[model samples]
Target: MSVATESVPVFAIAPAEDGQIAFPPAMEARFRPGLAAVHDEMLAREEVIALLCFGSAPRGEAKPKSDLDVLALTNGTEYWKRSRMINGVEVQLQVGPLQHWREDIEKGNPAMIDAFATGELLFDRTGEATALKRDAEERFRAGPAEPGPKFFQRQRYAITNIVLDLEDMAEDSLEARVLAGFMVLEALRFWCAAQRFWPNRKPWVMLRQLQGRDSSLGAKIESFYTSYSSVHAIAFTDAVLEGVGGRLYELSTDPEPVPS
Candidate 1:
């Protein structure tokens, strides 16, 4: 479907008062042409309805190597993804139905909710993108559902197992180091869920968010990574367990049914 550039609404990257682009100067220089090309390609499709720019680039936290993430909302039932190196930056494009994204927001899919709530609207054909974004923002503000007891119980059980495995391995062994890394990540996920915050996929971003919530815990976590000290790792794990009702020795199970 042909769409006039004048007809599609632009929300985030509109021109400034001085006739300059609203995006960061460096980012605009690097990705503007690439984004325009992708936009043109997607908007040309009859099923494509809206386009959103999310992740690090739009958040202004993008590193030189960061990929530009774009989501194309489509009317079709199928999903599509493409990756292209444009202007030395990889553009990651995702195409899915509008209702799929809306359901994801309603279900508290952290990534989807984050995209809709914080992403830039590059193209909107029917104003549906705007409404979806508003809904995502509202849900984000309200916070995720309090993770039920079963969630905590499962985390506790798994972490206890990891700690046991760590105890069995030599501190300097490569296997120990790998397991310690997994433990650190799992602990962070557990901590974030306990606090009703979505755990970021990126390690640095997750640590930053964790630090925002609790600097002391963040420091402990960082210490393990910086020094790879078994003590520091234990301390971090202990802190996480303390927050989540301590180590799980015996998992609570459902009551057995009495036979007639």
Candidate 2:
């Protein structure tokens, strides 16, 4: 539980008075023993270079059912995962090559960037984890790239196809319902990307972020979910499409000729 003082990174989460990593109280109380067990096991392996705790637990947003998410940086070539249930909480462990993780952060992988930026360093042997976390934070502060022409084209293509299919089906039919689901997902993705926001997978988190950015659109989306009507769904889709130059009835593409 004690890290070498010299090896600890300056940017790491502050250690406790006893020199152990400081975890949120709820997380510590529920997963301390289990975390210790896994930490010991990973530390015993020579290839394991560092361990970081991420997600809700380390972020102080844990609920009663939140799981502990740990990322193990290693010198291995392959990626793997291990999951265990400890005291009714899931202990999810992800092991991967350190270089691979660094590449992911450099490439703007949203989840990976978020994890390293906010993760608590539980163990660091070479200070590389701290460096990666620093890099992630910089990227996060810079925010996501603005959506380009290709991004809008792809979104419009998919959405236009979906709307076309919906137009041919009865509004209350099962097929229309299924297509409505796809429309909603596409709309959310388009809206988030246009607003330069990282799309969160969690429902409530996504909704809150969406509302923060555009209250009118967010309220419209919420109403669709609340009423479960096809009319509301179509209206929401139209609103999102309007932001990106309206619905496309016909899309023209000019293919690049293949080089011989």
* Top of the candidates by TM-score: 1
Identify the runs in model 1 with alpha carbons over 4 angstroms from their true place.
1-28, 255-260
What lDDT tens digits, residue by residue, belong to model 2 across residues 1-260?
A: 12233554544333223345555554557777667667767776779878888888866778888888999999889899999997777999999999999988887899998898877778777778877877888888877889888778878878878877777889889888878877877788778778887757876776677889888898889888887666777788889899889887766667979999
Pick by lDDT: which candidate is best?
Answer: 1
Q: What TM-score does candidate 2 reach? A: 0.83
In order of appearance, the predictions have TM-scores of 0.84, 0.83
Give residue 179's lDDT in candidate 1 (0 to 100): 86
Weakest 10 consecutive residues of candidate 1 by summed lDDT? 12-21
For model 1, name the residue pairs that clash.
Answer: none
The lDDT per prediction is 0.79, 0.78
Which regions in candidate 2 have their CA more than 4 angstroms from the true location?
1-19, 25-28, 63-65, 75-79, 256-260
